[model samples]
Target: MKDVYITRISKFLPNAPVGNDEMESILGQINGKPSRAKRVVLRNNGIKERYYAINSQGEITHTNAELTKEAITKLFDDSFTQNNMELLCCGTSSPDQLLPSHAVMVHGLLANKNLEVNSASGICCAGMSSLKFGFLSVKSENSNNAVCTGSERSSTRMMASMFNEEAESLSSLEDQPIIAFKKEFLRWMLSDGAGAMLLENKKNETGLSLKIDWMEAYSFAYELETCMYSGGEKQEDGSIKPWTEYSSKQWLEDSIFSVKQDVKILEEHVISKGVESLEMVFEKYSKDPSDIDYFLPHISSNYFAEKLKTGIKEKGLKIPESSWFTNLSSVGNVGSASIYLMLEELVHSGRLKKGDKILLSVPESGRFSYAYAHLTVC
Candidate 1:
């Protein structure tokens, strides 16, 4: 197979940056009361401001497809446009509707002639999955070029209205006046944005391009239960009861459709599994961690930053703090869009030089999966 390169990267963050204090105002209060977990979650996530598709009035300014379109549009210029794009791959955790696939909706928004479209569905690693599809397609000579996008219009899901029914139901029972931390904690953590990248068989002639050295993903679902999820409830047996299994009334009462995380599972498995996955990838490729010039990790919260460092170091990959790059503090956790956003910023930061090696790591708490990629500056 031939080599592939990322020729261009772009991102779109909807609306103005909403500060920590402005989140509750934009998302509104659940049960007409402020979130008890908001402050704690925000403090741990270390996000000062984040973008949201929802305006202050709670009106949605853009859907997930629209966000993906906007970012993809930014990838083109007079020399390259939608007419030249041969393949499109979109990934996301939050799509506007359940019926149409997210990539088709984005293709509809772009109004481009039909070519090939694929959608990768999951949490954060979904973005990397799309990138991998594009890279492999170009590498195998199946496509001349591919446009890959990762986006989330999650603000709509995080709105107070989504949880008000469940919170009210809990209040009525009086056994618990608030929703569980598993359901409410994510409200403060996730934001909205979209990012797109162009992949081609040849590197750019005039500017820098990221040569795709390798990309690999691993899943431990057989060895672990779900740790983060939405549109489902975690049962006592550690299995998920899908949204379809619940009645509409039950959906509203239990917030079965709201995003939730089994924090205990997350705390116990995420870092350790991530380290093990990375070690396997490194061994497979005979890669040495000390050769990395930049390390970009999609960490959901700053709380895990040091823990991830310790875990990886114990495994012999000791990337220093100065070599690390992340925009999470400013952009918040955009889920599937995060790694794309971080890569976009780094590519445009004017810091890359020839022969530089960049390492990307995205750990998905959704059933404990991880994706790692190595790129070289050309």
Candidate 2:
């Protein structure tokens, strides 16, 4: 087997940065009333600005595939272009359509020659899953190089129109009605963006490259219920009733297709389960947490940043706050693309040095899944 390295990284955030006060103007108000939870959500998430693929007029400027293609295009120069790509892997929780795979859609936009393509579907961890696939492919010598992408066009689904039906339905039963906090809260939390990375067996000659030391993933679905999801409803028994099981009209009335989260479950288990997974990975790989120079964690909200540090410290992993880095406050939460975006920024930040060790952590609340990876600067 051969070693794998991330040779290049790029990201694309659509349109201009939308400020905190501008979100309602862009997404519009549900039932002609501004969200009551918007201020609190934005404050807790600590996101002052974010990008949206949709304009103030609610016109879509780019699709998920288009965003992915734009990020991938930025990865190439005169020396490396689409013609040189051998394998393509795309991961996203949001896709333009449900028929064709996301990778094929991105490939169609690139208009490149035929190559091995794969798509990974899930929530935040989807990006890391794509990276894992590319890492293994290059490590096993099955592919000389691979282009991996993670993106999300979440604005299309977060529009107020998507939930108007549900808001109206609830209004009929009560004097003053608002959509559930679980669904309304995410509107202010998510944004639109795409990120891409190039993985190869050899490190870059001129600039810094991230050598993939190891990757690990774990799922607690058997012990936990779904916490964050879309196109389905969580039953009282902790099982999900898929969108297909609901009537067409019920889908709109309940906003069944819109993303929702069990905030209570997320707050209780997200950090604890992540620490458990990190412990397992450290034990299996004989990794020492104190050796990490930088720790990049994909946190959906800033509220959990300190909580994660506390939880991990209790487990004997003592990564200090100064060593932690994140761009969530500036870019907002991009779901599956967040880790990629964070990594892209760090790679270009001019802070890395030879022999530096970076640790990545991505926790997906979609049935409680976690992915961790270690990289070394070379």
Q: Whole-model Cα lDDT per candidate?
A: 0.92, 0.93
- lDDT per residue for candidate 1 within 41-154, as digits (tens), equals 988889998999988888889989999999999999998989999999999999889978999999998997979999999999999999999999999999999999999988
lDDT of 1: 0.92
In model 1, pairs of residues that clash are none
Off by over 4 Å in 1: none
What TM-score, computed on C-alpha atoms, does each candidate reach?
0.98, 0.99
Where does the lowest 10-residue lDDT sum fall in candidate 2? Answer: 314-323
Residue 249, model 1, lDDT: 96
User: Residues 1-378, candidate 2, lDDT per residue (tens digit)?
Assistant: 999999999999999999999999989999999889998998789998899999877789999999999999999998888999999999999999997999999999999898999999999999999999999999999999999999999998999999989989999999898899989889999999999999999999998999999999999999998999999999999899999999999999999989999999999899999999989998899887888899999999999988998898888887766779899999999999999999999989999999999999999999999999999999
Candidate 2: lDDT of 90? 96
Clashes (candidate 2): 0
Clash count per candidate? 0, 0
